[model samples]
Target: MEKEIDFEKHLKNAIQEERKLQVSFFDLVSKFEKKISNFDFENNSILISDYFYSGNGQKNIMKSLISENKVNKENCREYSTKEGNLKYDFKGVYFFLLDNKPFYVGISKGVIGRICQHLKGKNHNTSSLAYKLGLLRYEYLNNKKHLGKRKELNFVTEVEPVKQFLQKQKIAWISIDNDEELYLFEIYCSMKFKTILNSFETH
Candidate 1:
């Protein structure tokens, strides 16, 4: 009986401490909310439509952005891959907007590289949103739901329209070097903006 009472006391103290921490965390979140509210995403935004296509055909979106001086070369870091050396922008949260409203919100250490993956990558790991969009298209066209693995989706044909759709959208980002705040701000932006493509589900 005495031990039970002691446990209850400890639990009460812990809950009180947790509540205090929540208050402190929420105060910080309030500051972030104000910062996000004041952020000018319009003039600062980079439009993908201008860089989506070249004289030949659809071009590499990242390379076009870099070539036209839309993305800051000084902030990009290059690394070698089997294909060739590629550059990625510094850490930040990025937003994909359609009609000037946020549709997706994402975070990455390499913001530009991650966006490239979404626009150009062929597989689910590299182009998840495109894959989902393609899957939806497949279902809509076939009038049947896909029950197999996402990898089985026909990227060459199905994802082409999805990539085209993404190319017509606009992108904007804010640099957040701190990982904790970066993650929290992503969720906050997704909620505040009511982004449709963001999923908080754990894999």
Candidate 2:
């Protein structure tokens, strides 16, 4: 008889090992660069495989280049940003993708609350005008601010036409605990993707 494998137990063990490896990897990487430097941890993790490590080559190449340049104040300044702790409790960074390209990149301890603020436009998350327009409920469109300079307020004015543009959008995210690291990663993603909705200068 074939022995039954405890898949759930196996997965739990594998997850624990991955956690240990992740911590060790972060510690080692931190030795080379400042803790808040822009490193894409999630995508890099996905590139690793059982046959060969994809990230190792890239990491080495980057390290060599950085070594030649010498990590300096300017480099650190370019990558680091300071942000306040989130009021909600869903720690991670997220991306709103439109047509498979990043439309906006942001980080928050409370993903749902932050996303709500963006869509609902109640908490000064007006930067994501595209997202807000797409997700705003019909009931909330009464405000003239949402209508903009259009003098003619019409019947059935949920701005349904604008909503169509945001179709085929998707969201991707990775959990991050450290606020400084989260800020750095978000900045990095914004710069990499060049998301029009994100104001990188502000972080």
Candidate 3:
């Protein structure tokens, strides 16, 4: 008979990998903060930078807002139980960079989960990164003309390619403890960065 897969072992390994990634990303955040010493900031803003894909070129820098919860051993304990979890919730507002530009700003309580969804092209709603990129590609092909049947077909076919292109894009984020502040910060970043992937209008 075939051997059974040890799902519990797999989950433990995955969590460990995720924790390592977060720790490294946080270190990158610190370096970016020091690099941008000259920029003025709002009350909660913090700066972070990193390459979109691992083994890529130079990192991109962007601003983020600080959250009430700080990442420490007490709060951000790594996998230590059978449950195998990261102690701190990976909650935050995150930005997606395309061609070293801020393309989207979003808030997520499960930061990695949300980013994975975008990378996998798992969401298809209007606000989804995949959907928006598909729309951008469709528009580029049409050059702002009315949607036609062939154009619609073309758009549908291009979604995968768009996702593939974006899968390697880099990201930077900061935690926001409160949901209200998270949304507000997302809006603030969207406006400040003039991010193209944001659908909601904000002043």
Candidate 4:
């Protein structure tokens, strides 16, 4: 047989492909939780598949969100965890509903920072709703979306149908973020959209 495949190399390459988003996270979550009981994923990354799979989610999320048109796998970009560093990256909007409203678009560079800033009204770009909520920054993540732990940064950016799918499927919120920033991103996205949604619901 040929030499063993280089998993890390494959992951680095996968980071740039939307197909990575198609992983069966439910199975992974159950497996991860079984391995580490009481482990919270919503606030973490879903890139726990050894290491190789981690690489692919990053670039793909970015490419998916930013690209208006679906990116061709042939034209995707390759990246690595060592090189394409992302400490605080959440550069896309999450669309959703609260009480049957439509349209809630917002973006962030630092999911945690942005949410805090929004609550404090520090950033002008933040959704106005975040300010009125009077919530503080979150260091401890309670819970997030379905694939909370596994979500990579580029998913929000690269995957086009995510928000639409969420909206269509009537999910409370759909989000995207970095390797370690998914929870914060989910919080920010929900906060942003919550206002738009709740406001309409009350009015």
Instruction: Put the candidates in lDDT order, highest first.
Output: 1, 3, 2, 4
Which candidate, 2 or 3, has the higher TM-score?
3
Q: Distance from true position, residue 31, model 1, in Å?
A: 2.0
- Candidate 3 stretches greater than 4 Å from native: 1-89, 144-156, 201-203
Global CA lDDT computed for model 1? 0.76
| Model 4 ranges off by over 4 Å | 1-89, 95-97, 100-103, 122-203
What is candidate 1's lDDT per residue for 1-203, written digit by digit as tens?
99999999999998888333333556658778787888887866877766544342223555666687666666666555557755555678898888777888999877876777788676787998788788889999999987888777888888768888888888888877667778889999999998777899997
Clashing pairs in 3: 52-170
What C-alpha lDDT values do all the predictions have?
Answer: 0.76, 0.46, 0.52, 0.34
- Predicted candidate 3 versus true structure: per-residue lDDT over 1-203, tens digit per residue: 12235777777788888332323434444444343233223322322222223333211111111133223223221233235644323567767765555678888765544565565533464226776677768779878743555334343576656866765565655655555556556766677778767768563
Model 4 CA lDDT for position 167: 22
Of the candidates shown, which would achieve the greatest TM-score relative to the real structure? 1
Question: Measured by C-alpha RMSD in angstroms, how accurate is candidate 1?
Answer: 7.6
Number of backbone clashes in candidate 1 = 0
Clashing pairs in 1: none
lDDT for each residue of candidate 4 in 15-109, tens digit (9 for 90 to 100): 97765443355543444324323322232222212221223344444354345332223333333334465443343333333334424433444
Q: Estimate each model's TM-score.
A: 0.72, 0.41, 0.51, 0.21
RMSD of each: 7.6, 17.7, 14.2, 19.9
Number of clashes recorded per candidate:
0, 1, 1, 16
Q: By the lDDT metric, which is better: model 1 or model 4?
A: 1
